[model samples]
Target: MKMIRNVAVGISGGVDSAVTALLLKNKGFNVTGVFMKNWDIRDETGNCTVEKDYEDARWICDKLKIPLIQLDFVKEYWNEVFSDLLEKYQTGYTPNPDILCNKNIKFNKFFDVARNRFQADAIATGHYANTSFGPYLENFKENTNVHLLQAYDSNKDQTFFLNQIPQQTLRRCMFPLGNYLKNHVKTIAKEASLHKIAQKKESMGICFVGKREFQDFISEYIDDKPGEYVDLDSGLSIGKHNGIHKLTIGQRCRIGGCENAYYVFSKDQKTNTIIAVDSGIHPALYTDFLITQDVHWISEEPHELRHSGVLSCDFRFQHRNPLITCNVYKISDNRLFIRLSVPLRAITKGQYAVLYSGEECLGGSIISYPGPSFFALNQQNSIIETRCCDLIALTSGVQM
Candidate 1:
């Protein structure tokens, strides 16, 4: 609807991003595809999977007749994303590296590389997210305020992963697939003679760890730090693990000859111990509050929180989990204290807690540590009735 603008589309060799480039071309924008190589490691089979992905990305660029640029961010990724992930793992924290990748690499370094190096007027990605800048940045104008929102396809919405990036970075971005469903994006790709790309399996979570066992891949980075499996109730050692990094909270770590199956309730890095409960759904696995010192707000801080020192909204620390009601208390400019409507299972420290008011993404903060578990509280006040539950109950499901 206006003068043609040069757009740098981050093509990740997937169906969604391939279609993203096609959409930009169809919209009369000067589309240029850039494929970023963030990781250089091969899989267990000694095959460089990233090479195959790059080939597919090249094919798409050829078919679309748009110039493709390849950028190597392996160094930046190692320093910005991987090192921190390893540190968190070593400390017995279950961190989501995807969100960090988005914040530091995609929206941060990629934005700078695309704009300064390539003369890109704007940036585009295959992410399923939207902005107040309009779906395609069609309504974007200088100095106008921007707000991140969930994609039309809520199932594939990636706003949680994007909540940490800077506000100005979002202002100059375009999400062409924001309003399109996964199937529809595939249909568009197929109709445009890019069916093979469309048929490519979607990349979920981290890509560098492709098809490799997480523990095996991670072992290459972190050494084996032996730890003990202690019973949460009796405080007795029931089992031992070669590495605490290999285990996570809420995971069923049952050992033979034990009186009952046990689930991980917590991890003590200093003591090199993994605390466990007899039942997977033991009340010890649930918590209703958490504190965080790293909180990022989009656009501006909410007026309600600024004035009243509190804000109630929907929250979910995990992307696939359903949004739950919560009240956010502003402890400081950089700190938050969140109280959930219902006690949730395995609310681990180091995971990001994203809060939203309806569809709009307000902000997110890292879960520094969870409050006392129901089991811990029961010892003091006998609040929750404990039970021996099955492994199936150990999920993100709410606990009343």
Candidate 2:
């Protein structure tokens, strides 16, 4: 197929993107390298890493012989992704920043600026996911009707992070590295006489605003206060906690003092209290239904099956959860009901409950709160204890 010549590829000063730009240039396309400065985060000790990132990106662009452009997006990052994350944490729920970052920065901000300012025909990246144009184009606007598919390298497939983008955006985006596995990418980088690029380590872990503990980084924007950690079974106060923002549901470490290992059950923001219980086997951990809001349906409405009475569905990224049947009791512009086939454990609030129908990902939203248990919330305590599983549900009542 003939290729679109003018392209802007996002370079994060990483091997993945470095290879992407080289591949595009190899195909005789006019490629301009763009280094996106999304956050001003430093290393763990609070030193700026921006210069290192810029230098690395510049080095790779020079080797690839492409014009390197820098786009500072710190303001957009705070407004679109990080600010919402802090609000969610303030309410005592875990927020996935990577998911939001992929949506707002890499795709939205990059495409918007690259196309409008640079007059580029297409924006490209090193994402290990596939994209293809749709069959029809009469009704399609620019970059519309695109399809996102799993990358050839399944282990590194990042389709989960790119789900929020609409079909059109995918159409204009390029993934030159989508067809190859990681090892092959390194091999190609080496064969291209870029051995050092091949030897570079991959970037991992949370994208922080500065070099600090996650709690400390978040604490700068959010307040910290003392709270109580109570036993799930006994309802007795076991210890004092620094703040509700410091912990997440289903986490097993750092709380200090418990007979058996305890997992976070619930956090009460109003009272400033945490409840945890022994990570015991309980059918209650497995829930049959989940409540959700802000539903973004990916395909045609789910067709309900008659044979199976249970309507369980996955509530995590990339079908990470088991295949469970779920019934959609109700759905509106923003709210909905999901009845699961079996009880599953640790249904967290504030996290997405992305439903699936076989290979296709149906759209989902933050679990605002868990539905009432078929049985009591807990057997050990007179009052119900919140577990990590209830994260999605409790996040519903959390104020935005």
lDDT of each: 0.88, 0.71
Clash counts per candidate, in order, are 0, 33
Worst 10 residues of 2 by lDDT: 134-143
Q: Write the per-residue lDDT of candidate 1 for residues 319-382, one digit (tens) a residue.
A: 8999999999999999999999999998888899999998999989899889799988878664
lDDT of each residue in 1-400, candidate 2, tens digit only: 3245688999888788888988888877898999988778666666666777788899999888889999999999989998889888888777778778877888788898988999887888888876544211112246234455567877887766665665545667788777889999898888887787778777666656543567776667777898888876688988887888877766663556556776677789999998877764533344566687876554334445223423445545223454556666555657767766667676767877776554445556768776454335444344334453366467777632
What TM-score should be assigned to candidate 2? Answer: 0.82
The alpha-carbon lDDT assigned to residue 7 of candidate 2 equals: 88
The count of backbone overlaps in candidate 1 is 0
Whose lDDT is greatest here?
A: 1
Task: Indicate the residue-level lDDT of 349 in model 2.
Answer: 79
Badly placed stretches (over 4 Å) of model 1 are 1-4, 382-400
